[model samples]
Target chain A: MTALARALITLAVPVLLVLLAVLAVPADGPTCLGIGLRIWALFACAPATSAWLWWRQRAVPA
Target chain B: MIAAFVAVMALSLLIALWARRGAGQGPRAFFVAGGQLGAILFFFLSVGETYSIATMLGFPGGVYAGGEGFVVWFFGYILLAAPVLAVLGPWIWRAGNLYGAVTIPDFFAAHFNSRLLERVIALGAIALLVPIGTMQFAGIRLVLGALAPGLPMPLLLAGAGLVVMAYVALAGLRAAAFVAVLKDALMLGAILLVGALALLHWPIATTPVATATMAAQVPVTLPFALSTIAVQALGFAMIPQNWAFLFAARGPQAIVRAQAAAPLYMVMFPLLMAVAVFARRMGLPVDKPDFVFLAAAQHLLPGWALGVVMAAVVLAGMVILSSVCLAIAPLLTRNVLPGLDGRAQQRWAQGVTALFIALSAAGAMAQVPLLAMLNTVFYFGIVQTLPGFLAALWTGRVRAGGVLAGMAVAALAIIGVRLAGISAGGINPGLIGLILNSVVLTLVTLMFPRRDGHSVMAMLR
Candidate 1:
């Protein structure tokens, strides 16, 4: 993918995760459950971010 | 337990000194660790700022004392800000590298070619950092007091401050980064262990497991949560120490790789919440709300493990305090006192680091009302520099005069809002100040665009 394409994916990744979070995690759930879901969501978002960054690193090599 | 705590503290100092063995010489070497930190050191250092004593104790304590709502903004800010850093951090590295900048003031002054603006940022940064350095001591007092109830709080804090000063004096940023690797490992282990224990021994709950994250009586209102997250997430990008850490990176890619992993580190938060709930469930005597995490861990862990946990907490505070001292040292010697050569700068750095520690310790000991208020506004005030920094990085259209004027109006706006005693319904006042600052800055720049014909973006490219 092009750099612009990768940038767009990086931008889009958060929105998609938010959408999935809304579907998977209940906002008004139990505190522990809510915390768990958020962590789960974070797990989802964080690794995805790393993958995106790793891909972007190739285009702009060190 | 006492032996364990002492050993951990010694290890932290040893790692810091170890970082300086065979290290390059001169002010830059000391300040930015010779600007050759690989991805691992940069990752540890950058993430170090996120998991401070505040996270270890304050996160759980806030939840145990207040409600789970406390985690919303705290976790939100950390989780959301990673991407922002991942995007902006490399760019910040680019800016810092373009001008060989060690401090934010150094970057601003070099980019704008304005000594007066440098002074403004340097003074503002020092004022902003005052509360932050002291807050670490506040945590130190709380953690050490819990561990060794026999030890005097004042003496413990003073000693912790001295040790942090020693770290700065020893290797500057490299010392902080090297020690950060140990602090992070121990902190993460402690949190995960205590949290897991809390889960394994989950008590029958009087209340439901699904306690609401945003309770009606909770102080962390929805507007406040959303607004604080937004403002702080952006402001997190603008923090001075983070900049210093990023500048230590070998290049922009190191920043990219390091910050990319920062968000994943927040995996510790859920466990933090678990530990908080554990404290509440067992009806632990949380006389001081901030001690809830330590109280729970003390209840769960055996002597040696407790020692390791306490050491982690203390070292968490020390690493951050050392980073703040590092940030301030350069501001004082390099930007604030620009005439010092390498030898003179290092000499002044030691004295300045010691003086800063002394003053911060004095203020923390006194608990002056004004210092407390400054703590409240530090984040808001710190971000006021963001506009000017962005202008310097992305365009030459911005003038030092414009940046200065915007920051002045923003500071006054925040002061006014505070004096009026308005919460804006839990919204952060600094966000308001930042908006007004941006508008004023835009108008001033438009009305009087620069004729210097220098393009910062072009130069960087």
Candidate 2:
């Protein structure tokens, strides 16, 4: 439920932005979700690379 | 005008002296205020740390110069930083408290049991942090130059420099914490006063000049906004000094609470942007673009209020930065020096702090590109630490060999990325470095796991 809420909240901004732009770009309406997806990609991003590097350090038990 | 600044300096120094008396015991008090700071003190100091002279001065100037792109960077910070702090801060606080760690290297040494690696991390932190300190000093000179134009720049710099150095050397973080109270009070008063005056002087429309300038500069498209948020968010979590605040929190719960509360800082960004928009509309000629706060304060405020604002911005930079450098230097000296007694160790640490300050000040004078590049360059080191430090505390199985190796790879990759200059397009290389670092650590740990020190981990949990 939290994830659903988060996703909905995140999409709301881009959706509004695209909707506002749609009156001008009638043919571009289909591409709005693609735009939303990219924005969502940005939102979902974290500093995961370091977590990956840290996780690589598992010591072999003696 | 000079007399006013002199008066402020004298008062700041006296306040610093009085405050220094309360700090109990030795290095811990000097470095971390013995971890006894209250919430109000913490809130103000943390905010003062955030609202550096750069943010106070350069941020408005950035909006004046580049329109809304920088505003995106500014606002995204709260989003990026709060969560990272919430999750990581508590763990670090617990570990730091448990080990009685005074510096980042102390914690590193305790976790890895390798003094050599600890010293290396210490040196990396000092090397990166110096430029940040230098910028603060440079900012002092700029404010003084504008406020008291008749006084020589060198004399003004020297006066401000001596006050900062004395307070930091005498009272350490306790002095900084107390001084930050005055600093934040002046800062809040100045920001609000200037903001109100600018609004009155040139009342902006609902969609201000910044929006118009940015709209003219770049189309209000999805790619622009997405990329803007992406770069800012990534860079926000990777700002080395800001990220290091996690280690200083009272505990995990304190960190978590601080993170949850930090979003309040974000709400003010748009307000600051509005002030800049008003300033720009009123035809403020800002060539350097880092002089907006001082310019606005001088032009818009009464003489007494202007003096207060100038002192606040300068001291905010000087005090916080000096404490940071002072705290960082001992971490290196203690780990690197061999067979020194406690007194000798203290003397050496003080010397290192002084030297670090001198070198960084010189770099500022020289205008070295390396120092200028420091804002982003240091994030590489911090990203490397993320994996080793977090894993060691969270799960007992992470081996030193694998942790160190993963760090090495991440460091190399970040350096390579930096050399390519791809990260300089405002995207954070540290974020990419972090991802690589975590992945390597995870894979290598799973392949070759350690079971020793499992009991220590259990105790913490």
Candidate 3:
């Protein structure tokens, strides 16, 4: 994949996840599901961003 | 319990001593492990730092008090910090290597070629960092005092201070990193044990309302949480010890690789939140909200396990305390008081470390209200340097004068907004100041760009 492709996906996924989380929580206001979804979104960024980073720089020597 | 605690504590000392094998005699080896930490050691050191005493104690305490409102910002900041570090981490590593920078000020001084800028940055960092030391002690006082209620506060502080100082004296950053390998392990075990117990002993027929109430569910302040997370995540890259950690990596890839995995470490947050909620549900006798984690652990774990858990908490504070001292001391010895030979620098580093610990301990014991105020300004102050640092790396627009002026204005703006108590509609004061700082730095740089300088970006291109 191109650097631009990687960068765009890297940037978009987290933003969309966060936006979905924000809308759900405030719209629902305060539910356990809302809270869980919110936290899960934040946690999801770990793998999303990390995988992208690893893919982009996999061959770069440490 | 006391025996387990003592055993772990003693083991840490031995680990520090063991790290002294073939220790070099200079500020370089003493401060940055001679700039030779591989991905694994760097991972331990960096990941261990992100989970400081604040994370162990203050995080649960926050959840216990403010619930999801607190966790959002706290967790979000840390979660976002990984990506921030992943992107910026390699650049910082390259800068450190390119400039042979040990301290943040060392980077500025070399990049800007201005000793005065170095001193100014060092002074501001120490002001920001000293209170951080006090924060550790503040948490330490609570944890240690709870363990031995009869122990004198002064004596307790002195003993903790001595152990922290010894880490620096024994092997400097290497000792901290080496010990961090074990410290992080114990910390994870403690959290898992407490979290699992919270789940296993969880009331089987609890209602959603009760769970919500226990979690202290409130209207999440999205604006404040988002702003705070943004400034703090960006500023984490600029923090003094973080920069030191970046420099400690053997290479750019080492730093990036470790940071890419850092956010996974905070997976314990849900567990922390569970522990906090369990404390509330069980009505544990928590004298302070911050003690909720300890309270839960104490109630759930057996005596020996509790001791091991408490020992991990202590190391959490002490290792961070030692790391802060290690960061600040060199800012004084190497950057502020330059021209010291390697041996002299090492000696001065030790002395400065001791002094910072003592002064912080004293402030904590005295319970100086001013220190509390400084604590509020700590992040605000540290984040002011961000404009200067970013300018140093990617652009030639920021001259020494521009960076210096930007920081001065930003610091004043942060302090002023804070003193005036304008909530700015719940936005963090640091964010406001960072904006003004960036504006001034850019405006000034535009007014007076240097023709002779090229950024690392330009050179690479």
Candidate 4:
């Protein structure tokens, strides 16, 4: 993959996850559930993506 | 409360003095802790600087005023920022190490070999950051005045300024780092204690989990929240002070480790917002929404615990203020006024820190907007530099001319939109400016591509 493509993916993946989390929030259900989903996306999913990217970068020879 | 404040301030000063012990006398040590900060110290410093009075006071106040929506997006954005930092931080550190760069402009100067570009960036940084320092002072005054009404406001502001300036001048980033450990501890303790009390004393629910949903009283549109999260997270990583911290790391790996662990510290925010939501339910009488955290603490905890909470809040403000003052002073002395000798530059930085702190204190005395609003304006200005910085990192296409033009265009757009009160479908002005900044940067770079491959690109490899 090109560097530009890789950069785009790196930026897009977290944003996509956040967007999906926001979309999954029910309009009228328990607010705690919505809050939980948002927190999971930020604290869990986002960091996981970052760690994955870091690992990938490390795996590649400089 | 008074005794707790005094004790906390004394302890902070002692920590600052201790941090000053091994710090060598030089610009690098003063500005970047000699680029020798270990993982733990770097973690403390990064987290401490990022989560400031805004986290403790402004965040809770936002929840209190606007409901869970205000804080939920912030959480998302901050979490997202960590990963970006994790990826880019090491590269920045590498560049800094390669060039012996201390400030953001130092990186630009060495990379592009353009002192003119360095001075422009420095001037922009100083112009943008002085208001932010003033905002910190305003936040400190609010926290102190809410907790200890008996203390004189002017004296409190002056003292706060003096203490922070002394520590920053004496130990620089080391002082901010060491003091951050104490600030984070107190801040975490205070947040947990208040959150637990709020959960326990929740009148509406039989269990703590049931009360979590009660905080989502106000409805937030999905578009606004998502856009906010996107822009804010990006802006957070781009802030010049944050960049300085990246440079101060022992290595790229330390930054990644620190970024990974920083999220754990942020768990306190959701709990704090829950407390704020609970306070709103109880109809806590607060004239300002930012006072929700303090008001709830006063109502729920005993005087001693409230004192601890106040100390945490106040110290968070001071640590951030000190770090910011340290960050900008070097930009002023080293880049903006490059005529000074090494020793003279250090002296000038110290003097500038004190002067800036005093000026910020005086500004804080005048009535300003809420913490969150001031923060928005600050981020709007700072994030304009993002396109250029990213272009520098990713591609060798962009030049100093393109960067300067992008910045000028973005600044004008931000000011024009803000002054005219133009709303782009509820999108943040900063995001708008950043979009324009990227466009201008790309167009200009494509128009005037560099023939020579910069050495900075080789450093990145």
Candidate 5:
């Protein structure tokens, strides 16, 4: 993939994860699991996305 | 409590004096700590500035009044913003180093070759920052008044402002950096202790279970939560004070390490949110939502513990207030009055710092709005600059004229919408302004593309 494409993908992953969590998690009812899922996705996705972007930038020639 | 307050303030002053030692004299030392901060100092400084009185007082108060839904979006935005920072912060640091930029507008002016744009941005930043400083002033008053019932509010406000100005004017960013170490340690300890005590005293249910059930009952809609998180996360990333901290890093690598470690520090928020919920369950009488954290401490903890927590909260306010003042000083000395010599600029910065603090203290005394509302106004205004900043950072296609035009339109739109008191279907005004700003920017850029041969990122590299 091109560098721009890689950067776009890197940005998209976190936003996509957050959107999924926001939409899938019910506002009412047994939300312990839902809240946990949202929090976990955020915690996991941010660092994961950062690492991916960093590695991609390194792998590609500037 | 008063004795504890006196000791903390004395120690903070000594730390400021120590930070001043060996630091050379000039705008560079005062504004950017002579660019000597290492990874650990950078980490503490960035986290310390990021989690201010807002985190300690305003946040739990939000959770207390609004319920667990507040925590969801609050942490959501904060968590999501970090990765973006991890990517962009290093670039900002590089640009600042390359251009010898002390403020956000300095970077913009140097990159765009437009002194006019720099002045406009500086004016916009000052306008936004003063209200934020006012919010911090109000927060200090709230925590102090709750902790010491007999103390005079105006006297406390003036004293807090003076102390903050003294450290910031004496040692500049170093004062904030060193004080941050103590503030963060005290803040974290106090938060954990409060959380644990609240849980112990009012063990109604497991934390998750209680918070989840509270989340269900609150009126926070999904749309509101999602939009709030999106706009606030972007705003947080682009706030001027945060950008200054980014520029102060020793190198891009230091910023990366700091960004990676920041979320770990935010684990305190959830613990504090639990404390707020516990306060609610325990039938605490909180007239003002912002008092929830202090109220919990007052009602639940021992006198000595309450004193320590009060000191921590006060330190949080002072450290951030000092940083905000320092952030604004550069805009005045460097951008607004660009004709001054180095010595004159430093002198004028100190003068401007004192004047700005006085204005904010006066606004805080008026107390026309609540603390959180003042903060929201700041966020709404600052994020309007993001389109301009991103264009400058990422592309050569967008011109300075286009960016400024977009920002102007967005600012007017924000003011109009806010004044109308329209919610726009649960969307935040900042997000709306950002969307409109980007659209205008794209249209204007297509009409008047930059003739520069290289992208800003490439040129900087």
Candidate 6:
């Protein structure tokens, strides 16, 4: 991956995770299923981001 | 419960003996565990740190006592510090592999070419690590006191102390690693089972009510809760002791995978958050906020299940922390002290580690709040190193003088401010030191003439 691409992806992954966490926990509220869903979302991002990064980096010389 | 305690300690002793049988003797055996950890063991070891009694107890209490602000900082700032490891761990491993440096202070000496700096860092780390060591003693006693409240506190602490010292002295980091696997598993299983059962008695919808009821019960806002997650995340991945395990990772790729896999540990936080929230919603008295995890399990689950969960939480507290302190004290002794040959140094390292633990245990028994004291020291000491280490890797021109100078200034500021009882708002004073350290490093590097790359690398050694 190009330098810019790697940097952006690296930055975005954490930001996305943090944003999802904020949205997951209720604001002035409690949501049981929402909490579970938010955690699931956080977990899903890891494999998804890893795959995307891996596939993108494949074009570079190994 | 007593039987369960005996079983866990017996199993730990057996593992310690097994690990020692093939393990090399002295500091190499004690400090790095022969530096042969693979991805699987490394993963558990790293995650076991994430599952400290602080997280199991202190974090949820923050969420319970404070409101959403604690939640945001708790979970959010963790992501702030992880990218640091992505860069720092690889270089540390490579350098350690090249130089055969087993401890962070050794790495400091190698990187800065200064024995004095290495000693300072080691001293800072030991002072910082005292809180963690104290917490371990307190955590084990808390567990013992609960399981058998009739047992005298000193006797309970002594019993746990004997177990911790025995395993650490006999087996070293391998014992900690072996126990980490069981600790994390026990923690995971117990929290999940208890969380699920807690939901049965106290619906998730009523969590806020529970939280509100418990809030009125606290004497003050939890002292260290607000910035803990950030402080923890930043320092957690960076501590010379824990990060030494990064050196033991099989290679750069294993380090990357461990870094990548680290976020998964974040999922457990919410489970802990749920328990604290549910317990509060149920109007449970969290007089000792540290006991919230155990209290939740006892209140929510069946007798047998509670027994199992309590044993797990207590064991997790004892084994994982003992492992960390075991490595930390020895690392301090070996790297900080100068003019010693390898063989002699190794023996001295073991002696120092034992002394460090003994002092820490004594402090905890004197009624110092272990969790708070440990966090304050750890956050201050480890965060200062972040800039020096990070700049050395990512920025080629970062002078050794600049890094050293920044660390000195930052250390002074933090110590000075702390002695004055002035905090830097919610952010840790250590982090403030880190900022100064980074700025000085960047500015100094930009201003100064670049040294020859070969000489710089040589100086780094």
* Chain B superposition TM-score per model: 0.94, 0.87, 0.94, 0.93, 0.93, 0.86
lDDT of each: 0.77, 0.59, 0.78, 0.76, 0.75, 0.64
Cα lDDT tens digits, model 1, B1-461, are 98999999998888888988867887678778888888888898888866888888777777776643456666666766776677777778888888888888888888778899999999888888878877777777777777778977778887898789878878888999899999999998998889888888778764433243323224666566667666777788878888888888888777777767776677777778778777777777666667878888888989889899999998998888888888888898888888888778778877877777777777767765543346547778888988887667556888888999999999998898889988887778888888888899899999998877355557855
Order the numbered candidates by lDDT, best leading: 3, 1, 4, 5, 6, 2
lDDT by residue for model 6 (B147-227), tens: 888878778776666777777777777777777777787788877787777666665444344434345222322233334
DockQ of each: 0.37, 0.05, 0.39, 0.30, 0.25, 0.26
Score candidate 1 by DockQ: 0.37
lDDT of 2 by residue, B250-289 (tens): 5555555444455444344444555666666555555455
Tell me each candidate's TM-score: 0.91, 0.79, 0.92, 0.90, 0.90, 0.84
> Which of candidates 2 and 4 reaches a greater DockQ?
4
Instruction: Compose the digit string of candidate 3's lDDT tens values, residues B210-299.
Output: 333344323347777777777877788888998888888888778767866776677787788788767776766776677889999888
**In candidate 4 chain A, what residue range of length 10 has the lowest lDDT sum?**
A33-42
Provide the DockQ value for model 5.
0.25
How many collisions between residues are there in candidate 4? 0
What docking tier does model 3 reach?
acceptable
Q: List where candidate 3 sits over 4 angstroms from the true fold.
A: A1-16, A23-36, A59-61, B204-220, B342-344, B368-376
Work out how many backbone clashes candidate 3 has: 0
Badly placed stretches (over 4 Å) of model 6 are: A1-12, A19-26, A33-62, B21-26, B77-83, B203-213, B216-231, B302-304, B341-347, B369-374, B394-399, B416-426, B446-461
lDDT of 1 at B115: 97
Q: Model 5's A-chain: what TM-score?
A: 0.52
For model 2, what is the error of residue B184's alpha carbon versus the real structure, in angstroms, after optimal superposition?
0.7
- lDDT (10s digit) by residue, model 4, range B364-410: 88865544566677777777777877788777767888888888898
Model 5 CAPRI quality: acceptable
Lowest lDDT sum, 10 consecutive residues, model 5 chain B, at B208-217
Clash list (residue pairs), candidate 5 = none
